[model samples]
Target chain A: MSGDERWIHTPPRESATFDKHAIAEIHRAAATGIYDIRGFGAKRKVPHFDDLLFLGASISRYPLEGYRESCGTEVTLGARHAKKPITLRIPITIAGMSFGSLSAPAKEALGRGASIMGTSTTTGDGGMTEEERAASSLLVYQVLPSRYGMDPDQLRRADAIEIVVGQGAKPGGGGMLLGQKISERVARMRTLPPGIDQRSACRHPDWTGPDDLEIKIIELREITDWQKPIYVKVGAARPYYDTALAVKSGADVVVLDGMQGGTAATQDVFIEHVGLPILAAIRPAVQALQDLGMHRKVQLIVSGGVRNGADVAKCLALGADAVSIGTAALIAIGDNAPHLEDEYRKLGTTAGCYDDWHEGRDPAGITTQDPELTRRLDPVAAGRRLANYLSVLTLECQTIARACGKSHVHNLEPEDLVALTIESAAMAQVPLAGTNWIPGKGGPF
Target chain B: MPTVDLATAPVRELNAALHSLQPSTNETVWRVQNPRGQHAIAVGLDAPVTVEIDGSVGYYCAGMNKQATVVVNGSAGQGLAENMMSGRVHVKGDASSAAGATACGGLLVIDGNASARCGISLRGLDIVVKGSVGHMTGFMAQAGNIVVLGDAGDALGDSIYEARLFVRGTVKSLGTDCIEKELREEHRMLLRSLLDAAGLPDVDAAGFRRYGSGRKLYNFHIDNIGAY
Candidate 1:
C-alpha cells in the first residue's frame, strides 16, 4: 500500500485535550476580536435522560396489555389565581421562540401542530404575531425583559401570560438577534432600526428583583382583570431558590428551562459552560415546590433537551406536570431534512449537523428569513408532519407507561427508573440499576 | 356624579366595578373618597371617563390606564400612571418616584414636584412637570418628551434614547450619552405643543434647554463592546 493509504489502517493518534474542535475554536477566536456567537444548545454531551433506564414490570410487578389498557396523558396548567386555566389533551407543549428568529410560517406551523395535538404554544421576545395567535387556540404571551411589543390590548388578548426573567442557554446574559435576521417587520415590532443587531436588556426596565416582581404580578393581574393565568419562567441556574421565589411571586405555573435549551443567538462560551442540565435541575425544583406545599397545586413545565416520548415520560416521572419542546419541534418542521444535504454542504456543514441558525440561511426554510429559503417550507404539510410526530411521541410514552403498569403517565414515579451510570444516578437522584442504592442518599432506603 | 368609598367596599369589588364600567354609561365622572394610600386605584380603565381621587393615592395608581382621565388631589405615591397608554393623569400634589414610568402614550401632567425617575422609559408619552423633577428623570427613555418647567435634579436624562428632554432650570449633571442639543424651530414648536397640551401655554418654550441622546450606543461595536 502507498504511504498515505497505509496510515488509514494504522492506529490513529490524536490528543483529546487539543482536539480539532478546540483548535478550530482557538483559531476562530484569535481571528475575530469578539466571542463566537451561534445558535443551538451545547454540543458537548452531559448527564442526560438516556443514562437512566426504566425497569419494566415483571413477575414481582404487573404489566398491562398494550392495546387493552388505558393510559391518561391529559394535564391542566395555570389553575392558581387565574379565572381561566388551560387544560390540554396531552402533557407536551411547544416552547417559546420569537418571530424574529423563526420565519412566520415556522411559527404558524408550530401553532398549528400544537393546536392539532390539543396543546399550547408560546410567543417570544418579539411579542405575539397574528399568524401564531390565530393558529394557536391556547396561546401564552411572554413578557420578556425587552417588552418589545407589549401593549395593554394584547395583554387582554392572550390566553395566559409568562413573565420571562432569563433563558437557559445563557442564564445571566440576554438574547441577541443578529442584523441578518432583523427584517422590517421585526424592526417595526421591536421599534429598532432595521438591519441593526439588537441586544435585549438582561433585566426588566420597570421591575428589578422579586419584591418588584411581586408588585409587577399584581399589576399584570389588574391589567388583565385576573382572567388569564400568569407564569414565571427562569433559566435553571439555581432551580431551588428560583422556583421558590417564582412561587412566592404568585406564579400560577413555573417554566424551568435548563442548560440544554437552544437559543436563537448567544455567545458560544455561554452555551456549554452555563447553567445546570435539565436532569440535574428537576429534583431541586420539585423539592422547592414540595417544600412550599405547592407541588401539584402550581404546575411545573420543564424544557431543554426533550427529544421524544421517552424523554417526556422520564420528565413526567420525575414530577414535571408538562414538557415543552423547541429544537425537536423545529426538527419536526423539517429544519434540517436529509434532502437538504447538498445545500447544507455549501454552507460548510452537513444536514442534521447544521446549527448556525443565526446566519438565517437555513436550507429547510424553518429558520431563515430569505424569501427564497422561506418559500421552501409549506406550512400546511410541515404542520401535518409535526402533528404526526407529536402523535407518535404520545403513543410511545403511553406504551412505556403501560409497560410500567401505570394507568396514567403522571403516575410513573422515579422508583420505576434506575441509572445505568454512577454520574447519572447522582444527577437524577435515582437508584443504580441492579442495586437499590442511591449515591447521594444514605443507604438503600 | 357617582361616589365610591374605600372604607366600606373591598378593593376587589371597587376595582371590579371600575373595570366593568362602559365609556358611554351614565358614570362618565367618578369621585373616589378616602383613598388613604391604597394601591392600584383607577387601574386598567379604557374609557373616556374621569376619575377624581379626593385624597392621597398609593403605589401603581392609575397603572396601564387607557383613554380615561385620572386626577389625584393629594400627594401621589410610587409608580403613578405607570405604563399609561392614552388620555390624561394629573397629579395635583407632589409625586413620588417613577412617575409616568414606561408610559407609552397620553399626557401626564404633574403640577407639583416629581421625585426620581420622573419619566423613566417614556415611550410616546408627553410629560410636563410644572415643578422640579428629581434625579435620573427620563432614564433610558425611548420615545416622546419630558418637559420640566422647574429645575431638574442630578443626572437628568441618563442613558437617553430618542426621547426629548426640555428643561427650564438648572441641571446637576448629565448621564452617559445624554447631552443638550440646540433648540431649533422644530424643537420650539414641539416644546410649545407639549406646553399647550399640558395647559402651560404661558411657559415660554425658549427658556427650556433641549436634551437628547448623543447617538452613541445605538449599535454594537467591537472596540466599544465593554462600554455598551
Candidate 2:
C-alpha cells in the first residue's frame, strides 16, 4: 500500500535487453595473437600417444646403458614358404610408390635411402625400374589388378612380392595416372593410350575371388620357383576377416593401411570417407591372427599416420609386428619443404596445405615430372636426410624404452596408457585418465 | 637328337641335366616325350639347345632362357617361357593369356591361336601369332614387334607406347590411343625377319596391316583429357 508507481512484480531472475556485443573482436585477438599454429599428430587434441609414459624401476628393475645394451630391430618377412626369406635391419619399410607418380630420381632416392638404413622399398602399379632395383639392396615388387608392366623376369628378380588388393586412402578405388605423369615409358608398361588419364581396374582380370587368388598366388610362386616371399596388402576395412583370409590365401605377410594413408591420386571423398583409423583397426587384425594361432608367425605390417617413435611404439605395443611408412617418409624426404613456400603460395596453398599429388605439379620435386624442379632435389642428400631421420626415430624409441624399464621396444603394453578422450579410450581400449568411465564399454555417452 | 622322357623324370632333374651341356657350333636337339604338363623344364639355359615338348606344359617351361629354342606341341598353361630373353619359342597349339609377357628379347611364335594380352609389355622381343589375339594385347608395349596373322580382340594395344602391332586379319576394335597406320616397307621387313626367326614357312608379310599410336596422347594437354 506504499506508492502506486513502484511495487511491480519482483522476480527471481532478471531480464534485460541491450545492444549486441562485438563477437568477432574477441575471437580475432585470440586466434591471431596466440592460438593460430596447428599442432602435429591427430587433428583432435585428445589424449593421444603422448599420454602413455613408461614406468622406470628404481630397485625392482635393472637399467641398460644407451650404448652397451642391444636393441634388435631385425624382422623376417615371408618365413612360411619363401625359399629365401627377407631379413630386414629395421622394423620399418618404405611402401609401394610408382615410378610414374614420382620421378625416376625420386624413386632412386627412396631406394637409396631405404637401402642405407637396411630397410626395403617397394614398387607400385608401374613396373620396377632398373634404377630403383639397382640402388636398393632389398626390393619388394607389387602386382596390381591392371598388371601394368608385369614381367615374370622382373618378378623373379624381386626379393618379395606384394599383391595389392586395396589401398587405405581409397579402398575400392584403383590406381590413377594423370595425363601429365604419363610418359612414353609409363604408357609402354600400362598398355594405355599415351598422354591420356589412366585408371587401373579394380579387380584382376585373370583371378576373381580369394579362392582364385590362392591359385594365382600359387602360380606366382611357381613362376618365381618359390624364390621370393609373397605379401597380401589390404585396406583397413574388416581387417579381422581380411587378415584371416590373407593367411588362408597363402600370404607370408599382411600389410594393413588405415584411413589417414595418402594416395598418389584419389577422390577427396574416398580419402576422407572410406576406411577405418589405424588405431581402431590394429587390435582386430591382431585378434584374428591370434585366433588362428598365427600371430608373429606371419608378420603384420600396419601403416597410416606413423609420424614418430611414439607412434611406432604404440603400434608395436598394440601388436603390430612391424610398420610401413609412405606419407611420413615422403614428408621426411622434403615432400613439403618449407623452402618452396613461395611456389606453394602460387599453387593456392601453403607448404602443408599442398596435397595435389594427382595434378603432378608438385613444387618440392617429391612428386613431379618437371625436369627443372626435379633437379632441385639431390638424391644423395635426400637419402642422407631420410637416414638421419630414421636414426633419430630409433633413438627416441630407445629412450622411451629405457624410461619404461623395457630392454626392448616391444615391451610396451596398453596398461601403460590412460585416455584423455572417449575416442582415445575406445580406440586404445584403456581406461580414461582421472575417471572410471569408458564410453563404449559401459555404453555410449 | 636326344630324347628326354618326362614320364620318368622330374622337371628339376631334367633341367639340371640340360644345364650340364657344352657349347656346340652344331645344333643340338632334344625331344621331350610325354611332357604331360611338366613345369620349369630346361629353365635358365644359356646354351643354344632346342627343346621340343611333345605335349602340353604346366607352367614356365624353359623360362628365362637365353639363346635356346623351345617348341611346345600342345597348349600351355599360364606363363609359358615367361620372361624369356634372346631365344625362340614356338607353340603348335593355342597359348594361354599373358604369353611372352615381359619378355626382354626373343621370338615367340604361336602357330594356332593366342588368348588375351598376348605379347603384353613385350620389350625388344618379337611375337608372331598365326591366329587371333585376345583383348588388351601388346598393352603398354615399350619396344617390340607383335605380328598377328588373324583377327585381334578389342582394345588391342590399349595403352601401347612404342611397340608395333601388325595384323593381317580384321581387328575387332582398337584400344585407347591405338590407331591403324600404313604398313610401310620397314614394317614389312621387320615382320618378315620376326617370322623368319620364329621359323614359320613364308607367309605374306604384305598382307598384314600395322597398328600404332597417333602420338596425340604422348603429352598431357588439358584440352584432350578423357574421363579415365
Candidate 3:
C-alpha cells in the first residue's frame, strides 16, 4: 500500500490531524461550565422531516389528472368569530417574525412572498410597521406580553390577532433582541434604547393567567367590536392543557409551535432541550380540540420544522388545519447559500453551519442590517422564488393526495401513517412499526 | 345634530351613525347626551369636529382619531385614545390603566388621575395627567412627553428612551436603569407648552422633576451582566 493508503488503518496519534484551536476553545468552554448544554437540534440526531416519504397512488388507488384534478389547499383560519377571517389560498402561511429581530427589508420580503402566494404573514414581539402592513395583503398582528406597539387602529386594520404566550424555540422564555440587531428604526418603533439587548416580559402585564386571558379576550373583542378573529399561540410543551386553555380563553384559532421552530436569538440550551418536538405535540393539541367538541370549529395552526410537502401532509393528517413556516420559508428564499461559503468561513462556519441569525452578521444577507450585504437580496426575485417554491409544495401535496385516493388534501387521516420511532409514534399518535401499540392510548387508570 | 343613544344601539350601529355624519364648519359641536360607557365611541374620525361625551366611556374611546377634538366628561377605561394619529382627546375624570397606549401622534390630556401603565409603549403622542399614575407608567415609551402632575408609581419608565417623564409629586420607585434627572430649560418649556395647550393651570414646570433612561443599559456590557 502507498503511504496515503497505509494511513487509513494507522493509529489515531500518528494519523489524525487534530484541530488545536477548536480543542483549546472546547477546553476553555468546559472549564467555564458552558460546554455541557446542547444547542437547537444538537442533542440527538432524530429522523428529520426529510427522511419521511408519502406512498404514491397506484393501480389499487385511482389517480387524478395533474391539471384536471382538484387537490384543494385553501385553509380558513379564525373562522369561529373573526369578522375578517384569513382565507389562505394555500395551506402554508408565514409564521410570526418580529421587526426588532429582522430588518425592514427582510420583513418586506416575507410579506411580499406570502402575499404573492396569497397567504398571510404574521408580526412578532416588537409590533407591526406601516411598511409591513402596507406590503402584506393579509397580515396577522401579534399581541405579545410586552405589548410593544399594539394599538387599536393597527388591530382594526389587521386581518387577525395572535396572542403570543410562548414560542416553540424557547417555550416560557421571553423574547430577547441582542444589542447588535437593534437599529434606530427598530428602537424607535419598540420605544427602546438603540443598541440595547431588549427582553420582553414573559407574562402579560394586564392579565396574569389563562383565567384573566378570557377577560382580556372579551375586552379585545369589545375594542374591535367583534371584527377581528383572536388567536392564542403557545409552545408545544403541554399541548392538551394549553390547547384546552386556548379554546376556553375564547380563542378563535390556536397556534401550537414545536421544538424544531426557529428563533431570532435564544440561548443554545433553551432552543434545543426545553420543548417537545412538533410531531409529538400535534396529537395532544388535536385531542384537546376533539375533547372540547370544538374541532374544526376553532382552527388549529401547527408550526416547526415544516420543510416540504410531506411534512405539511403529516401535520394535516395529524389534525392541523394549516401549517406555518419560519426557517423553511427563509431557506426557500435563500437563507444559507453556497455563494456565502467564504463569508461563513470567515465567521468560522459554513452555509449549513450558520445559525447566528440574531447576530445580524448574516453572510447570505437574509438576516442582516448591513446595507452592502442586504443589497445582495433582490426582494422581487426572492419573492418570486418563494412563490414558486410554495407552488411546488402544493403540487407535491396534491400528488400525495391523489395517490391516497383523496380528492382533497384535507382528507388525509392519521391512520394513513405509521411511526418509525417511539418518539415519533408518541408525537404523531400513530401505530408503531408492526404492532398497534400507542404508548399513551388505552392505559388503565 | 343626530343623537344616537348607545344604551339601545349596538356598537356597530352607534359607530355607523357617527361615521355618517359630515362635520362641517357650521357644526363644530357634537353633544352625546346619554353616553353610557360605550366602547369605541368615536373611532377613526378624521374630521375637525368637537365631540363632548357626557358620560364615562369603555375601552378605546376616540381611538385612531385625527383632527377632531374628543372630550370625555367622565372617567375613561383602558387604552383610551389608543393609536390616535392626530387631534386631541381629553378625559376630564380619573382614567383607567393604559391611557393613550401606543398612540403615535396627537395630544391626550387627562385632567384627573390615571391608573397603571399610563402611556405605556407611547410613540410620539403627548400625554398630560393631573393626578397620580400607577405602576409601570411609560414602560417602553419611545418618544413624546408624559407629564404627571401627581405622584408616580414603581417601575415607572422601565425600558424607556428619548420619551421624557415630568412628575410634580412623590415617586414611589423607579424601574430598571430608569433614573430621576434634573429638569432642564428645554424640558420646562416643553412642559409649559403641553400644560398651556391642554388648558390646565400652570403647576410649576420647575416643581416637576425629569425621569429618563440611564445610557448604561443601552448596550449589553460584560461587567453589568446578570438576569437577562
Give the share of true interchain contacts found in each model.
0.31, 0.09, 0.22
Candidate 1 residue lDDT tens string, A1-445: 7878966685865779989899998898898877888888877898999999889898987987898889999998878899999898999999999998999899999999999999999999878899998999899999887677767787888989999998888888888788888889988787666876666767776666888788788878887888899999999899989999999989999999989999988888999999988998888888889989999899999999999899999998888898989999999999878988999999999988899999899888877788898888888888888889999889989999998999999988898899999988987789999998878874321
The residue pairs that clash in candidate 3, if any, are: A57-A403, A280-A427
Stretches of candidate 3 off by over 4 Å are: A1-68, A125-137, A145-158, A184-194, A198-229, A442-445, B19-46, B63-65, B226-228
Docking quality (DockQ) for each candidate:
0.47, 0.12, 0.24
Q: Candidate 2: misplaced stretches above 4 Å?
A: A1-71, A125-135, A143-158, A177-225, A358-361, A399-406, A411-445, B1-35, B38-47, B59-66, B102-104, B121-124, B135-143, B153-162, B173-179, B213-228
> Candidate 1 at A38: error in angstroms?
1.3
- Could you tell which candidate, 2 or 3, scores higher by TM-score? 3
Q: What TM-score fits each model?
A: 0.94, 0.77, 0.86
For residues B1-228, what per-residue lDDT tens digits would candidate 3 score against the true structure? 655566776666655555555656556667775677766677766678888888898767887677889999999887688767789999899888888776778899998899999987677899999889999998877778899989999999987766889999989988877788888898888988998888875477678999998766665554555412
Evaluate model 3: give its lDDT.
0.78
Residue A267 displacement (Å), model 3: 2.0
How far residue B81's Cα lies from its native spot in candidate 3, in Å, is 3.4
The ten-residue window of minimal lDDT in model 2 chain A covers A35-44
Each candidate: RMSD: 3.0, 8.4, 4.7
Using TM-score, give the best candidate's number.
1
Per-candidate iRMS values, in order, are: 2.0, 8.4, 4.0
Model 1 spans with C-alpha error above 4 angstroms: A1-13, A442-445, B94-97, B113-118, B131-137, B150-159, B170-173
Q: Per-residue lDDT tens digits of candidate 2, residues B168-226? A: 99898888888899988898888888777767557878998899866666554445557
What is the docking quality class of candidate 1? acceptable
